[model samples]
Target: MSITVSLLLWVICLSCHAWLQPGRYGLPPPRPGYRPALWGTRLLAPVLALLVTTRHDAIAGILVWCMTASLAGLVVACGLCFGPRIIGTDGRRVARERRP
Candidate 1:
């Protein structure tokens, strides 16, 4: 079960990372720093999920929890970094169409 959950989490994280790659949504190319943070998030997600599921050792479990929290934080950061542009553009289109 732990393995399956870890695999699922890894797949989701990888998909999200791939979707954020250059030209995925026709967005401008990402800055170099962006790649490392995004890749690190993708790499850590599976390890965290595994730790959460296989919490046999106390110290290991705590470390996994910390990693999971970091993963969540990175996800939030990614959203903040990219979400506004998508939302802002969509909102502008809707407003323009509604105008007289």
Candidate 2:
């Protein structure tokens, strides 16, 4: 059971980390400083998983950690993908959108 849980966490962490990369497998010069953030996700997932699972007996603690990880992953992905949309999106459509 612990093995399964650990593998699941690794998969989830890497997958979430992938989302943070801009290009294919983070190739072709990813956005500056993105790699460090990705590494953090990679390291954090398993540590957090272990921390939660070992602190309590049986599968309940693992389940709690799973829930927490899922929620956190959702937040990170959403924030990265839709961050620009949040700027002044008061149901208003502008004639000219700002460009970087």
- In the predicted model 1, the residue pairs found to clash are none
Model 1 lDDT tens row, 4-76: 4554575566545654653443234457777777777788876677665667866655555555546655664
Each model's total of backbone clashes: 0, 0
Model 2 per-residue lDDT tens digits across residues 4-96: 565567566856575554343332334667767777878887796777576756567667666656665665555545554322224343234
Instruction: Report how far residue 44 has shifted in candidate 2, in Å.
Output: 4.7
Clashing pairs in 2: none
Per-model C-alpha lDDT, please?
0.55, 0.58
Deviation (Å) of 32 in candidate 1: 1.9
The Cα error of candidate 1 at residue 87, in Å, is: 12
- The TM-score obtained by model 2 is 0.45
Q: How close is candidate 1 to the true structure, as a TM-score?
A: 0.38
Measured by TM-score, the strongest candidate is 2
